[model samples]
Target: MRPLVELVGAGYAYEDGPAVLSGVDFGIAEGRALVLLGRNGSGKTTLMRLLSGGLRPGSGALRLDGEVVAHDRAGLTRLRTAVQLVVQDPDDQLFAASVEQDVSFGPMNLGLPVAEVRERVESALSALDITALRDRPTHLLSYGQRKRAAIAGAVAMAPRVLILDEPTAGLDPDGQERLLDVLAGLRSAGTTVVMATHDVELAVRWADDAAVLTPSGIRTGPAGSLLADPELLSSAGLRQAWAPAVTSFLRTHGFLTANAPGPRTPDSLTTWR
Candidate 1:
């Protein structure tokens, strides 16, 4: 599949700060769940900003649909319509008094017709399963609810690519599972999902592809096999995800075949012989 968004030899640096990311080449393919992983300050957020048109590259280029993205008003407006980014903290993104109001903000700003805005808001709320919370005060929402509400605002824009940063950070296991279900629904409906997370286990189970930021630059590969490498994980400041011990035991004990495929999620192990 071709990338909906791509970065070729991209680089960035904050005023006088040493370049945090340099010589990076990456892409987010259409309709795939891509997990972005790295140590603190690994440029995961920077790369995301570059993709979403939040930041212009200091060098190289970002392409959307195979064309270099323009940084002008019309160019950005077009880009914003197709790509949306949700920050990690819900509080940072949520400002309106009510969930419905907040969710409506993006489409409203896009100058969409009232009818279309209303339709998009309703569709987004339903997609995120937050319809019941529409009239609820944003301040009154729990962290998880606020998170969903923030994401709903982006979804209302009907983006082709959705970028989330540390989406599961504060959630408990159940919250994580629920969010996964919602993301699954989004993918099924044809939106490409890209997440930046530290949870290797979640990446193991959920990502179709992964891009890890290393000291040299960026590394991209199939999530299952790539994340399973301890050296690679360590180089990216990540600890082991799941357990190699259990997998090794299963294989040696003949409960799993040596060539058993990843992601090797629990369900994938249920029928191993």
Candidate 2:
């Protein structure tokens, strides 16, 4: 089956800078949570901009459902309807005074009817668990609340794919847990989520698939196996996730069987052993 979105032999470079990405092939499998991992300057954000229509690929093609994506006005409209990207900083995305108005902006701009727009706003607010803050001022919201508000704006678009750059960045542990729950709900509701993050633990715990950006190129595979590879992690300038370490220690000491599946979380130890 064709991926919902794909990049074929894609390459990108800034006006006068070296190519940040080259000969890349990426596919957004429908209904899967994918984590993009790399150190700073690995082009995760650049690649996301390409996926969301913010930046056109400098070479090769980006495709939606196998057809090459067009960047014209109508083309962009169609693309935006299918994909939405939330950046790292909430302050950069939030503008409307009230949370309701902020979350309503995207759907409203889509020219949805007031009732439909209201419904989407309510739904997104609920999905992010910020419905109570709907009437509150955006400026009055905490950093975590603002982040959810920004994500809620994207959620209100009802896109097929949502790409978030560091969704949990700047969030406290409780906030991260809450955001993870919100993400789980989104996936269960059938939205494909792609996130770029430095958190290997979160990748191991939450992602179904993962892509690691290295100087050589992008490596994509099952998060469980991919994150277990210490060499790959080191090459990508990422630390190995602790779950893999625990899995290794257990198996080496005969606490767990060698045939056991790679652990996804700390809780998996209990389940596996």
Candidate 3:
């Protein structure tokens, strides 16, 4: 099958501004997750906008399922519908009085049937486990609740590829866990996910492929390999997951003769002791 999305030599810049992205290239396959890693102002957001068809590239081309996406309104609309973007700030996305209304907004705007819209709204709320908040006012909810509502809104559109900007930002431990679980569920259901995050731990824990935007260029590889390389980690402004740090600490303290292989998840760290 063709990749869900591909960027070939894609570059973008604001009007008369310096180039935010240059010579960018990557491909996201169906049913796989790609995490965008970079420091602030490294063009991650610009790249996400390009992929979602929100912003056309100034140079080069972006393809959706093998078709060039440029100067075609219908194709762009279809691509936007298929590739939904969840903004970093939920407040900017949620305008409806209630969570259900907000979630249904996208499908309703697309002229979906009333029953289908309701079903999508309910299904999205269920997926995020926020069914209880469906009737609550969006503004009244906590930050985490609002974030989940924003995600539910995107889910209601039933996008094949979900692009999330800072999905784990400003959340407590519980909220982070909840959001991560939601993302994992989406990936398991074959929804390709591309999330832009500065959180190395989240990327290492959740993403299969990681791409880092740097002054030199975009670096792409498996998350594990990238995290294990200290130079790459520093260059990308990323740190190893908790388990790896603990393993290294144990080795330094002579608790282990050699640094053991790091555990994949935090829960698995308990077995190390």
Candidate 4:
């Protein structure tokens, strides 16, 4: 399948600041989840902003669905509708008085009819399992509920690509699981998910592909391979998905096989004779 988005030789930096991203080349295939991993200030958010056309690259090209993005009113509008971004803080996105109103905001802005807007809002809330919160006040909702509401708003826009930044942040384990299930459902329905996160465990379990933003540049591959490489993980300011003990034990005993699949969880390596 053709890629939905591509960054070719992209470079970006804030005015008078050091380069956040340089010489980056990457692409996201339609209907696949690509996880972006890096430490704080490693350009993860900057890259997302660039892709969503909120910020232009200082150099090189960014293309969406095979067309290069230019910094103009028309192009930015097109980019916004084609690629929607959900920020780390749901509060920043959720400003409507009620959840239903919030979800309807996007479609409304698109000049959709009342009927269509209602339909989109309902469908998005149902998909995010936030239907019950439709009548609730946005400020009254819990953290997880607010996050889902923000996502519902984004989905109501029906963007071809969804960019999520630290989506699982500030959530409890149950909240994380709920968000994971929601994301999985989106992937099943053919929505491409590009998520930035520091949670290696979540990336290993959920993402099909992984890209690391290192001090050098962006490196990407199958999630399994990227998660298994200690050197790459370290360079990316991340840790292995499996515990150090398990990694060391496997290495010391020669049980780590070249052909073995990357370990998905801490307990996944346990094999009883």
Q: Which candidate is the best by TM-score?
A: 2
Please state every model's RMSD to the true fold in angstroms: 2.0, 1.6, 2.5, 2.0
Q: What TM-score do all the candidates reach, one by one? A: 0.93, 0.95, 0.90, 0.93
| Global local distance difference test of model 4 | 0.86
User: lDDT per model, in order?
Assistant: 0.90, 0.92, 0.85, 0.86
Collision count for each candidate, in order: 0, 0, 0, 0
Model 4 stretches with alpha carbons more than 4 Å out: 243-248, 261-263, 267-273
lDDT of 3: 0.85
lDDT digits (tens) for residues 1-273 of candidate 3: 577888889899999899998888877888878889887888888888888888888888989878897658788878877899999999999999999889999999889899999899888999999999989999899999999999999999999999999988999998899888999898877788888888887877777888888788888888777655666667766666665576667777887766357556678866755
TM-score, cand. 3: 0.90
Per-residue alpha-carbon lDDT of candidate 4 for residues 235-262, written as tens digits (9 for 90 to 100): 9889877544355567568887645443
Where is model 1 more than 4 Å wrong at Cα?
A: 243-245, 248-257, 261-263, 266-272
Q: In angstroms, how far off is 253's CA in candidate 2?
A: 5.1
Q: Please identify model 3 stretches exceeding 4 Å from their true place.
A: 244-260, 265-270
Question: Number of clashes in model 4?
Answer: 0
Determine which window of 10 residues in candidate 4 has minimal summed lDDT: 258-267
